[model samples]
Target: MKKLNIVFMGTPEFAVTILDTLYKSTEVNVVACITAPDKPAGRGQKINQSAVKQYTLEHDIPCLQPTNLKDENFIGNLKAINADLFVVVAFRMLPEVVWSMPPKGTINLHGSLLPQYRGAAPINWAVINGEKETGVTTFFIEKEIDTGMVIEREAIAIGENETAGELHDRLMHLGAKLTLQSVLKISSGEFEAIDQSQLTEEELKPAPKIFKPDCAINFDWDVQQIHNFVRGMSPYPTAWFTMHNTKADNNKTFKVFKTTLHSSKANEVPALIELDGKLILALRTGSLEIHEIQMEGKKRLTAQQFMQGYRPEEWEITL
Candidate 1:
């Protein structure tokens, strides 16, 4: 059997796992890696390399960082690698020249099952929408974005209390395994591609990129909806609310990191802070016990720690 020549393209940590797995497999040889250019980050503002770039450098694989996908020089360099296949994960959209360079064609590993949640941030949107199940898909990249033909897929059930961070880790590992399977099967010409349009669109869901406004909490909704929103944005771009104290004449915003819903008979108004010496708020359907929080210009702290030296007589929360 002939070893397949592969070129990998990715940017984030989610893509690094599959690259590591492929490096160990004997059937595929990664000729080069393509990732976004390093950008300034942190307080020092030093250039920070992407996860895929770090992996490629550590493994002594050729790396390419192209600011312009259509640049003649970049395209020329990509063709010089002479790779038979291209594997993409957590990367930006590719032009026809790049995806068409390989004879065996290009395949992408998407976080969600094809035909559902076909966009950026699939894991985040899945939990935010309260989905019961989601999975990973390996597919043949077509002209349209994420509207590709499926090669292989594996579905996993979403836990009732699972957060976006938890789901992201689960799919990251699953995507790696599934991508390896697809590569091996394709290398031996033992796989078939299924058109994504053939799948039923009756229940299709989109996974659009999240923004800062999307992270703002809306307390007017029911408890379940708010809970889903909290979990979906937990650990990153957390759900937040504004607090105003009438007696102290102060206003502050707090971001909620972790919370649990508690049954309460108090009919406190929505977005109202019911302080019992701790940070507890009343939701539309139930009460919320804030586990972790961060006030403006302050580090994250537990509810107990936040209440240690701070006490407000009467405070109202604005959604």
Candidate 2:
């Protein structure tokens, strides 16, 4: 039984888990790591290594950070590794040259169960859509992103009010476990890759990348929809809105981190409302009580704490 030669491609902490597991496995030889190039990050603009790069370096694993995946030089180096299988997690879409290089085909561990959530930000979109359950999927990479045939899937319930950050961590670990299982099964030569098209049990849902406008808070939405939106974007690309003061001060943007939904009858014209000595943003049918928030150029604070220092006066939700 020869050990499987593996090359892992990934970028974030989520991807590190999959690469790390294969690296530690005795049945496989993790020859090299391919990750995103180090780029200027943070306020100091220092070159920051990706999570995958940091992990590989710490473990003394060989790594390649190709600025362009199609570079012949990078491709040549990859061919030298002569890997049996390539595993992808939380990584960019691969060029066919890279994915097809491995004999056993490239394996991808996705954050959501596919054919559903088949795009960049599956975990976030799942929570944003108010899904009650979501899980990880391991598949064989093909030309289309995340449309690869399914190797295996493990379902996990999404917490009722879990933020995307929370669900991401959960799926990260779960993806690692499933990916390991898939590798071992592949090594044993006793598995079948199920085409995602065969799974007609659930209607397909797309989890496209979320942009700036997608995270904007729309007060006209119902309470539950807004609640899901807030939680989905929390702790990253946070759901935000512009605030205009009565004094005609420069409008500031505030990111909503946490909130509590309060249902009520017809609200009073959908404006900021005071109830039980708390600041609640009125919506079409209910109120959204912001639990934690961060204003531009200001530290995070609870709604109560923020109110003590500032007054809405004539402040209103601005576009």
Candidate 3:
């Protein structure tokens, strides 16, 4: 049986796992990798290699970091590899010239089920929308972003208290398995590619890129909504809010990473409340027990640790 010649393209840690799986697979030959160019990052601004690039280096695979995807020279080099297919994950949008180069076409592993959550931050949006289930999809890369022909999909249940960071890790592994399966099916010419338009007619929910302003916590929403918002953004670009600390005589930013929802409202109480050493945020219809939080310029702390140093009565969420 002839092995499929694959060119892998991705940049982040999530992409690295899939790249590793494909590299080790007996059925596919990862001929080369195309990841983001090395750039300076962090406070000291040291040059940083993408996780996929680092993996390629350690494994002695051919790697290409092209500044411009459409550059003729890069295209020339890519064509020289004569790869059968391109596998893309967590990478930048590909120009048609690049995605159309491979003989068997480019396949992308998206973080969400197709025809839904089709955008940049699918994993985060699914959690924010309080979804009970989400999954990974493998599809052929077309002209439009994420609007590709579906090849395979694998669903997973989203936990009630699961954070977006946790969901990301789960989907990362699920995507790798799904991608490998899709590649094998495609290699054997036994896969079916379904059009997105045929999937569903319901209204689509987009997963747009999240910004700092989007991460601001809104206590006006109900408890469940607030809880979902916090969980969706936790551990990275965490959900936050402004609070007035009367005892400290200052307004501080509080980043909330974990919370539990309660339906009973805290009637006639301030937004920030404490009961039995627990820090809770009272909302309009319900309350949220904040389990993990971090004050500005301070390390993250549990609810007990947070209440030890400050009085909840002196703090009120700044609307």
Candidate 4:
């Protein structure tokens, strides 16, 4: 059995797991890696290396970071690799030339069960919509984004309290294992491709990209919906709101990192903070027991720590 020459493209930490798995596989030869160009990040605004680039460098794998996917030089270099197959995980949209380069064709490891959630930010959208289950899928790359022939899929149950961050880690490893399985099957010409269009249309749910506005907490909604929204955006561009501390004599905004729900009366109004003791806010359905929070122009701190310097009367959260 001949080892398949593979070209892997990805950018974030989620994508690194798959790349690492492929590197250790005996039946797959990763000829090279493609990642997005380095961009300035953090407080100091220094040029930062992408997760995929870091992994590739550590493993001594050739990496290409192109500003434009269709650049002639970049395309030429990719062609030079002459790989047998192309694998993409958490990467940007590819031009036809790139996806069509490999003889065995390119495949992507999407975070969601396909035909549904067939767009960017699937993990977040899944949690936001209060889904009970979600999974990963490996499919051949077609002209339409995420609308491809499915190669393999494995569903995982979503915990009620699970945040997007937790789900991301789970799927990252799951995707890695699934990708390896798909690659091995493809190499042996034993894998079957199922057209994504054949999946039931009635069950489809779109997973479009989320923006800053999408991250804002809507207290008017039900407790379950609010809870899901918070979890879905946890640990990244976190769900946030303006908090005013009347006792402190200033209006301060804080980012909510961790929160738990508490039961409330039926007639209670949404977003109403029944109790504002310390850093906790009581909502109609339940109270948001803030665990970790970050204040404007200040470092992240625990609820008790934030309360120490904050006055309940002076600061009030604006819904």
The top-ranked prediction according to lDDT is 3
Specify the highest-TM-score model's number.
Answer: 3
TM-score ranking of the models: 3, 1, 2, 4
Q: Write the per-residue lDDT of candidate 4 for residues 1-319, one digit (tens) a residue.
A: 9899999999999999999999999889998999989999999999999999999888899999999999999999999889999999989999898898889999999999998899998999999899999999999998999998999999999998888999999999999999999999999999899998786567789998888887888778777787788888888868877765655556666677777675444335433232545445556666656677788799988877777765444555576
Query: Tens-digit lDDT track for model 1 on 1-319?
Result: 9999999999999899999999889888999999999999999999999999999889999999999999999999999999999999999999999998899999999988878998888888888888899899999898998988899989999887778888889999999999999999999999989988786666788888889888988877777777778888987868888888777778888888777776664345764444655566676578777778888999999888877745533667754
- In model 1, what lDDT does residue 255 have? 85
Clashing pairs in 3: none
For candidate 1, report its TM-score: 0.94
lDDT of 3 by residue, 1-319 (tens): 7999999999999999999888889999999999999999999999999999899999999999999999999999999999999999999999999999888999999999888999999999999999999999999999989998999888899999999999999999999999999999999999999999898798999999999999998766767888899999988889999989888789999999999876446654437888666777877777788898899999999989888887888887788
lDDT (Cα, 0-100) at 98 in candidate 3: 92
Enumerate residue pairs that collide in model 2.
none
Better of 2 and 4 by TM-score: 2
Can you tell me which runs of candidate 2 are displaced by over 4 Å?
Answer: 263-266, 312-314
- The sequence of per-residue lDDT tens digits that candidate 2 reaches over residues 1-106 is 9999889999988888778877888888998999999999999999999999999889999999998999999999999999999998878889999999988999
Residue pairs in collision within model 1: none
List runs of model 1 lying over 4 Å from the truth: 271-279
Backbone steric clashes in candidate 3, count: 0
